[model samples]
Target: MTTFYILVGYLALLMGLGLLSNRFFKGTSADFFVVSRSVGSFLLLMSIFGTTMTGFAIVGSTAKSYTDGVGVYGLMASWSGLMHSAVFFAVGIKLWAVGKRYGYMTQCEYFRDRFESDRLGYVLFPILVLLVIPYLLVGVIAAGKFIQPTTAGLFPEAFPMPNLPNGNPHPLNGGIPPAVGGGVICLIVLFYVFFGGLRGAVWANTFQTIVFMGTGVIAFYMISKNLGGLKAASEAVAASDFGAERLGREGMMSKLQFLSYCFVPLSVGMFPHLFQHWLTAKSAKSFKLTVVAFPLFIMIVWVPCVLIGIWAAGYLGPLDPGQSPNSVLGRMVGQLVHSPVLTGLVGAGVLAAIMSSLDSQFMCLGTMFTNDIVMKKYGADRFTDRQKIWIARGFILFVVGATYLLAIALQDSAHVFDLGVWCFSGFAGLFPLVFASVFWKRVTLPGAYACILSTALAWGYLFYHDILAAKPAGVGDEEMLVFGMMPVAIIIAISTVSLVVVSLLTKKPSEAIIRKFFV
Candidate 1:
């Protein structure tokens, strides 16, 4: 009961912060979309870092490390820390400059102007939304899974998860149901997003970034102490059948597959939510702090989660039949923390990470729908600025509702880490197009079309096939490697090839357009 009240109090604080930020809303579409580009360097850094280090970084990393070993850090976090910073330096700064000068609020707008094809938004909008939904689900799924076990036994009779009549304890018994937990989070996020818009999101993200990172360090120290220090935890693994292999990447995954993961981090280049965050920067100089500080932040957040996961393998032993990897972090925290108030704080940190990313994604998608679809295709002159804001608000309502429903439906089949990798893969495959648009003057409208279409097709095919393909007869995750590499390698190749080939064969953009962007 104390833990539950603490969580409730923490949630109230987040909601209050989000709503309070909305009091600054300027009531214009541009203000609502990008906060009139008035953000400072420190705020910009916090907002960008907050949106990027999501549930996938915290909950998903820990969950996957339990399954695949400590190499999970190398597979995504190390590569992400390096590549994401590079992308911020090379891609993010330049986009911020162009977006500010052109009054652009979304990526689709930039692509349409770069290609001289209004219809390009029509094609690209749906594809970007499709990729982002999975990213949103990662947050929702993480929060729900994290809450369930941490709150268990507090509401034993109130929210009892199913158990055998034989009195055997189900791993999830007495935990909050995934739907109830996920729904409460979605509603809180939606309220702030709906009322405060992007400005609200940025403010909330800054608060969340501070909370999660600070609490994460505290949780790490406490959890390690509770487990008899890091040395004892490692020794536990040393004694178990898991052995020293958990310390390294050996035998858990193929070297080629692991190395090929470098391409996955490229997804940041094309994230619509990230594009909006970049556009919010007041100047190119604002990016300096973000680019410089991002890697350190990533290391601080990721190292703890991954090490805890590896340690769990040693001390916690095997998961039961009904237990999912997502439950590991929650169960471990709840069991080891012992102090109710401290346990709730740890739970809030996890939820903070999840909600920070969700706010950005929700705002970005709603802003995209309004700007690209309603304003561009439907004729913006017909609607007033107030109506435009409401349109965005209404659409945000629809998107969050649909996402929550899907998050519930897919909870059984999809886990957070793998689903996130696949989502990022789709975006990475589309990176060549964005990169060329910014750096290459010769990229043609046909090339941009080919890039977007081919990425959609390749990603759709690969994802659908992965779903339909049979897993091993035993209980293990089996992904079909394309020539012994993850599917992202092939999808990226297909997208890059089609982009370069079709551009050379097609007519280039006019000199006026080239000079507008490049010169």
Candidate 2:
């Protein structure tokens, strides 16, 4: 009960802080969407890093590491740490410059202008929304999974879930069910985002990043101490027959799989939320810290979560049949930390990491709909600043409702890591469009269109064949990988070929169009 109250208190404090930040809101659409483009260096870094490292980083990594061994770190964190920073430096800074110059608010706006096609937004807007919803689902699913187990046994009498015929509590029986947990989180995020907009998200992200990271360090320390320190923990894992292979290269991952994972991080280059964050930078110099420190931040969050998951195999032993891999982290925290107060704090930290990213994603979707769809197609001049903000808010509420429904429906679906990879792969497949639009002068509007279409077709086919089909029988990454490689590799290859082949074969853009973007 004390733990539950602590969790509630933490959420209330966050909501208050978020609503209070509206005092600084300039009450314009620009301020709501991009914070008047006045965000400083440190806030920009924290916000970018925080938004990127959502439940996918914490919950997904722990679950994957537990299932695949320590090699999960190399498959994602190592590559992402290096690739994410490189992409930020190479792609983010350039986009920020163009966005500042052109007064662009969304990724589709940049594409529409760069390609000189009003219809491009009509095509790209739906695709971007399609990709972003999965990302949002990952956060919602992970938050429910985290909260469900952490709050278990607290209200067993009131919220009694079905149990086994043998009288034991069901593995999934808990304090709050997925629907309620997801709904509460969505409402909190919506309140802050609705009032404070991007400003609220950035401020909330900065605060949540500190809370999660600081408490993450404490969780790691206490877990290690409980298990007789790092040395003993490693030895126990090494000695356990169940997880001994996790300590070696052969048991972790294959060479091709490891190399293919590198492409997954490329998805960051095309994230709509990330694009919005880049545009919020006060100057190009604001990106310097983000590029340098992102890898370190990845390490800070990933290493502990990965290590904890790896230890869980030895500590908790084997899982029962029909159990969720996502619950491993929360279960471990609950068991390892004997103090109820400590358990609540650790749970709050995990929730912070999950929610920090959700706000940005939800807000970005709203910004895109208002700026790209309503204002661009319908005309911004027709709507006042407050009206525009309301338009965005209304669209965002619709999105929130849709996503919440999906989160509930897919509660028993794929692991967070796999779902996230599928989502990121869709974005990564479209990376060629952005990369060529900036660097390659010959890329035509037709080529961009081809890239979008090809990527979407491939993503849809693979997702249905690999994920949705196999999900019924509990198939996961082990069964989903094609020839020991991920589906992203195939999608990227197809998208790149479509872009290049179509661009060379088609007529080039007019000189003025080329000069506006390229020269």
Candidate 3:
């Protein structure tokens, strides 16, 4: 009960902080969408770092490590630490400069102008929304899974879910349940995002980053202490049946699989939310800290969660039948830590990491709809600043409702890491479109269309066949491969080839359009 109360109090404080940020709101669509392009170095770094470290980092990493062992860290964290920073330096800074110069607010706007095609915005908007929604779902689902187990038995009487004839609690029972947990989080994020906009989101992100990282270190230390120290924990894992494999001594992942994982980090270069964050920078110099320190921060959040998951294998043995691997982290915390206060603090930390990304995603989607669809199609001159803000709010509300419904419908259907990887793959496949649009002077509008269409077709087929209809085997069971490689590698290959081949075969863009982007 103390833990539950602490979690509630932490949430309330965040809500209050979000509302307080409304004082800084400048009463314009620009302020709402990109914080008036006035964000400085420290806030920019914290906001970018916080937004990138989602439930996918904390919950997904823990679950993957639980199933696939320590090699999970090598699969993502190590690569992301290096790749994410490199992308920020190579791509993010350049985009920020163009966005500031052109007064652009969304990626679709950039593409529409860069290609000199009015219709391209219409095509890109829906695809970006489609890719972003699944990423949003990953965060929502992870939040529910993390909250459900941590708050178990705290409100059994008040929130008694009726059991079915077979003795199950229908969807869930005893704990907070994924539906309720997810709803509360969605509402809280909506409250802050609706009122304060990007400023609110960034401010909340800065604070949450501190809470999560600080408490993350605390959780790591306490968990290690409880498990009889790091050395003893390693010894316990060594004594387990598959100890060497868990410790990465037996080459758990194939060489092809290990190498394929490298492409996954490229997805960051194309994340819409990240693009929005990039446009918020006050200057190109604001990005210097982000590129330099992002790798170190990845180490801060990922190493502990991965190790904790591996330790749980030796401590708790096998998972119960029909249980979600997503619940591993919460289950470990709830069972291992006796103090309710500490448990509550740790729960808040985990939620901090999850919700940090959710607000940015929710806000970025709204920014896109407002800038790309509503304002662009209807004409920005027709709508006042206040009306534009409200329009964005309305669209965001619709998105929130749709995402919540989907999350409830698909609870525990897949692993958080796998779902996230699929979503990232879709974006990563489109990286060629962004990379070429900036660097390749000969990239024509037709070539841009080719890249988008090829990525969508390839991603759609793979997703339906591999992810939805015939679900791939779980992590450690077998690799989910198309022609003996990850789906993203195939998707990227198709997208890049179509981009280059079509650009060469088709007529080039007019000199004016080329000069605008390339010059």
Candidate 4:
């Protein structure tokens, strides 16, 4: 009853924020799509922070740290936040300057206008859809996982486990009806986002960030207290051979993979939604100033999660067969936290963290698919805002549906942390295209397109081998494949180099195009 009340209160707060912000977001597509380019640095900072430190990672990071030990701390280097900040400082400011100069509303618009190529929009459309859909699935899976167990007790005798062909019980414990936890959360996100648009997303993101961090901090303190303080936890870890042995070579690699996650913020920080957020700044000075604060935000948010992961390791011992450290944080909360009120609040906040990205991610994907992919390819330029809205709505439903199906299909034999790395790898493929588009003046459309295609193929090949193939359980250290951030980094390097070489060898992007984008 206490937990239920706490959850209700959290939802009420979120809905109130959505209702309050909805009025400010009415008007043009830009208003609906990008908050009318009026978001302040504070809003931008919170939005970026919330969206990047999403639910997929917040829970999974603890699990990764639990499984891998202290080595996973290197993953907290805040590469994504750093790179995202740098982009804001360097590339983002410039992108905003040009958007303001050209009255460009979207990244695809920027590409289309700068290159004098409607064809560029065609290329970007599919890329954005592909980039966003799988990523959104991750959030869906995270949310469903979090909510499933929490509310399971509610169903009780009504829940019945399904029988397999071999007569084993269905893997989902007592088979309650499908939770739709992810879908329910998405509907909440859509309610605020549909009416309030980008402003709503920003407002909700700011509030959500505060709630998420506050809850996480409290939960961390409780977790640490229950297990003894951090010093005691450290001593506990030292005493346990689990830290020294199983967490050995492969453990070191997992740490490397964690460190590699830094690139995500770097690459995704420049993503369309982020690019639009950068453009909304009141001034270039504010944009530049905001970068310095993000590193601190990353540290404050991630450190507690990491510490909690370490604590879980000592308390839980080696993860049980078929159990993941990713699940450890929630399980620990379920087992250790005495106060159901705080536990439910913390759980709701975690779900908010997951949905924070789900909303923006789907929105971005919808916009890209509609504006960049579908509209450019087939539709006339004079399409109405209503049409675009409907298209976006349809795409949102599609994205959620696809994610739900994928999560169900992949429920068995997959780890959340590993799935996260795979999704991140897909985005890493975009890093070169983004860099070349913004920085290298000579990077031709063909070169950019080739780089995008090749990087994706290379990334897919790696996933197929490491994830799809029947390799050993811990086969080829986690870092060697999906978790290995460096491999994606290396691919980015190669793709950029290859694009540069190919662009020089081929016809240059028109001189007019170069001057417009560079200027």
Candidate 5:
């Protein structure tokens, strides 16, 4: 199959790029973790923007629009366009400056010093890992979901399906299984990250970012042409049973819920991977272009995805029973694009978006585990720089494998948009702690501890009771509320209240501790 061959070629090119980047690796911990803090304006822009546009932007948005209609765009992308840049300007710049000055490598490292407590790093490490897995899962699962539909018939005998009663071939006649697709993609990401470290991830991200954004435009134009144009497609959907649902934001998503998504975008402020990217900036000025241009990049990728998904809602009608909305993007493209070459390019584009985020996430976790956990726990003075790099590589390998298996296990049940939103909510709920730690001069160690423990405990309870258990009693998620507000909104309140109340009532950090961080 030309599509399969082209897809393989794309994979090989990525591997070559990763190996090539290793040539520049300095073989030191600082260079591996943060590119020796020498990255410039353009690379910083590409990597930061690329890492943010995960499967959530491409696969999640398209699938969500397919189900929730054009309003899906309003939920995350519109808010993210405004909020993400605001966070980058307000929060990212400040973190980068402090991290550069203090020689910090991870968010937990910053916390450990900010509070003058090793116990804080120990407390925050597991929580950070837990939140990151779900977000990483979004990218891995999306890789599998997108690959299957476009690569159908490439392995029909190996992953065969039964024909219809009328003897017609099955819709998924032959496709790469989700498990296999996810595994292969994860392995490829691991290859580059293991060799290039953060530098490799950044370089790979720049290349993949360019590919996905450019091909996104091409796919949009070709698909619109295939559909007889967006205007004609809209008119057709408006005439269908799904018309009102596809065209408006009223039915499935309420005004309160729509507005509450603004809180979710605030999660970007707490992203560990994003923090790592911020520290890679050569100077504070490096962030200027990213803040100004991020919203436009969001528009470029998201507009095409949401528009295509709106068209697919009418074009595909009701999906077959048991089918996930994740299939909508590939199925729509495969059916409409028609050319194998074009189909391959779309597949490559989807994988590029997925992997761009994955590399950064994998690298960040490894860097954190090594810096905050391994070095501090064992003794930074004991190991050479090379050993530290190897330790990071080993941890990255373990996490990647764990995540790949988890993604495969949940492939059938997890919804892309739902999983991503939940992950972001956890990070968003903890944003108050991060914001206060950076800006609020009176924040205390006791207050920071209370904030993290309370927010995490509440987040876990709400996720289980409000979301997972809600289905048993016939309560739909969109209609569900906690005291007349979304669960995430409540989580933020708890985070803020716990920090302020506890800090006032508890012992304050010494003047020395305050002087170290504040000054």
Candidate 6:
């Protein structure tokens, strides 16, 4: 009964936020689609940060830490948070200035106008769907993990997750079953997301970000108290063989991986949805202010989640019997928290983290597919706003469906971190294009095209051989080539330098084009 009330409370809060934002959601497609291009720094900052820190970070990172200690920490992508902020200085602020100056509504709108090539915009659009769908899948899967069972008994018919009849041992021994949980989350997320668009997403994310951050502080405090405080928890981790052993294995590789994780934000600030948020901001000053304040939130909020991961090393044990370490957070709450009401709150907080990102992801995928891929490319200038909205809805369904299928197929796979890193690798290749778009002149259309195609081809080829295909005999998978973001960046830098040299020597973008866009 208590769990029932908590679930109701969480849903009501979400709906209320959406209703509140409805006032601001009025006006043209520009207004409704991207908050009327008047979002202030605080709101803009909160939305961007809120969207990026998904349940994947919370659950997947903690799970990896539980199994492998700080070594697996490389897999968490924490540096992405910092890189995302740095990107604001690099491109986000400038993007905002240009967007407002030109009255651009979407990334594609800006690109099409700047390049004066609908053909290029059309070509560039399909990648939006490819980039965004995999991310939405991660969000959906994580949300499903929390919601399916958190409200399991609240509405038996609505949330019919299975459990043991005897209650002696749990199903999957208290771990979530992927498919059943994943679907429920997708349904709830799709409902609000389809209607809400970017406005709905921003409002919901703002409120949920509060819940997520607040809960992290509270949970960290409670966990520390239960474990005899932070000093004792540190001692426990240092004393535990599991912590030491896992850290040792990860050793240099773990630190290297953590640094590699920075690639997330490196490419993230370039992501279309992020550009949308920048465009929505009231001014460049607001955008800069928001970026400045963002790292504080990351340091305080996210750092605690990592601490909790380490704390769990001492507080929790090897995955209960056959359970995977990834299930550690949920399993620990169920076993150690003791009070059902507190357990419900903790579970809901985790769900908030998951849903915050899910809404943004769905909206990002929907908008990018509709505006960039469908309307701009195929429909050209002939597409109506209503038609675009419908296309967005369709992409939402397709993206969700693909992710649902992936969740089922990859259920047995333990390395979710690898999947996420691989999914975002393509953007690393697009870095030079984005950089040159803002700061560098003499970046020709041919140069941009070469950079995008080269990065995609190289990364795609390597990803397929290493990740998709079965490894050949006697070949170590580690030696099999994980080119990752750094390699992709090197490829782009080389390509861009060569292109600039060529363009300057030959046919540069006309002075008129340079002043209009690049300058």
TM per candidate:
0.95, 0.95, 0.94, 0.88, 0.94, 0.86
Q: Please give, for residues 1-519, the per-residue lDDT of candidate 3 as tens digits.
A: 898899999999989988899988889999999999999999999999899888667767787888889988887889888889988998898889889999999999898899988799999888888888877888888788778778777677766777879986644456898888999999999999999999999999998999888877788788889889999987898788744367882466666776787778888888999999999999999999999889899999889989988888788777889776777776777677777888888789888998899999999999999989888878999999999999989988999999999999887675544666688898999999988888888998889999999998999898777556754456443557876678889999999999999999999889888777765
- The digit string of per-residue lDDT tens for model 4 on 61-104 reads 68767776555555554664567677677777878888778766
Model 1 agreement with the true structure over 94-131: per-residue lDDT tens digits: 88888988989999999999899888888889888988
**Lowest-sum lDDT 10-residue window in model 2:** 470-479
Question: Comparing candidate 5 with candidate 6, which one achieves the higher lDDT?
Answer: 5
The worst-scoring run of ten residues by lDDT in candidate 6 lies at 477-486
Task: Put down candidate 6 lDDT per residue, 93-120, tens digits, no spaces.
Answer: 8888788788776777777766667777
Clashing pairs in 3: none
* C-alpha lDDT of candidate 4 relative to the true structure: 0.69
Candidate 4 collision pairs? 63-325, 63-326, 75-258, 80-262, 80-265
TM-score, predicted candidate 2 vs. hidden true structure: 0.95
Best by TM-score: 2
| RMSD in angstroms between candidate 5 and the native structure over all alpha carbons | 2.2
Point out where model 3 deviates above 4 Å.
Answer: 161-173, 249-251, 412-419, 470-479
Off by over 4 Å in 4: 157-178, 244-251, 254-264, 373-381, 384-387, 405-419, 472-479, 482-485
- Native-referenced Cα lDDT, model 2: 0.86
Q: Against the unseen true structure, what C-alpha lDDT does each candidate score?
A: 0.86, 0.86, 0.86, 0.69, 0.86, 0.67
Best by lDDT: 5
Cα deviation of 39, candidate 1, in Å:
1.3
- Candidate 2 residue lDDT tens string, 7-106: 8998998788788889998889989999999999999988988898886577667887888888888888889889999989988988998999999999
Regions of candidate 2 where Cα sits further than 4 Å from its true position? 170-174, 414-418, 470-479
**RMSD for each model, in Å, please?**
2.0, 2.1, 2.5, 3.6, 2.2, 3.9
Clashes of each: 0, 0, 0, 5, 1, 0
Report the C-alpha lDDT of model 5 over 1-519, residue by residue, as the tens digit.
Answer: 999998999999999988998999988899999999999989999999889887667766888898988887888788888999999998898889889989988999998888888999998889888889888888888788778777777788888989989999887668987898999999999999999999989998999899888878888899898889878878878878875478888776778888877888889899999999999999999999999888898999999999888888888898888787877877777789888887788788879988999999999999999998899989999999999999999999999999998898888774544766678789999899889988887899889988887888788888887556636655554634676566889899898999999999988778887777775
